[model samples]
Target: MVFVFGVNFPEQRLASLERFYGVGPQLSERLMARFHIHPTAKIGALGGRQITDLNAELTKLTIENDLRRKIQDNIKRLRDMGSYRGRRHAMGLPVRGQKTRTQITTARRLNRVDRKG
Candidate 1:
């Protein structure tokens, strides 16, 4: 296993690095390039130094629990301020101007004051 912060990634798995909450393909590619790691490399192929370096870089970014907390805090702040977006979140509706007449399942599930991701 290869551990990034508190998360354990299987060594046999590809080192996509998108498992972190706030990380995406672009950021993952940037990180891999910064570490001189190839895109198709496996977690097991990483050297100890590379792993440490990657950890160091990851720590510098707002990811995982920190990012989640930040988003939740922003929602809470909006709610406290009674903003339109806050009201939408509280109502479990779309906050990005999506139509609410139908097909709002995703927004209803995700747009809430206590969001997990």
Candidate 2:
């Protein structure tokens, strides 16, 4: 199955970018620390970078402005791995984790959370 999400928001895009690289929690935390963005920063809490240039996208709205290019590039890089990592990417599993059997999942759970609660 394909994971389809709207990345119209910069905060959402930043989050999606972290996952796009398949970077783990440690790396994500480190990157956030280095970049000076709060670990719990919401979109409104961010400035400058959180603004997506709709005008830019409207003008140069090719892959350069599209998330599809980034996703394709990562997938290509993984495919070039030719083994282990590539296989994990293909299977949608964490390429660096040991708890593969239990942790390898997509957004299925998020879509079907316990609404009764």
Write down the lDDT of every candidate, Cα atoms only.
0.93, 0.45
**What would the per-residue lDDT of candidate 1 be over residues 27-101, giving only the tens digit for each residue?**
999999999999989999999999999999999999999999999999999999999999999999999899999
Locate the minimum summed-lDDT window of 10 residues in model 2.
108-117
Clashing pairs in 1: none
lDDT of 2 by residue, 15-84 (tens): 3224432445775576556556666665444555433332232234233324445555566576677766
Alpha-carbon deviation at 64 in model 2, angstroms: 9.3
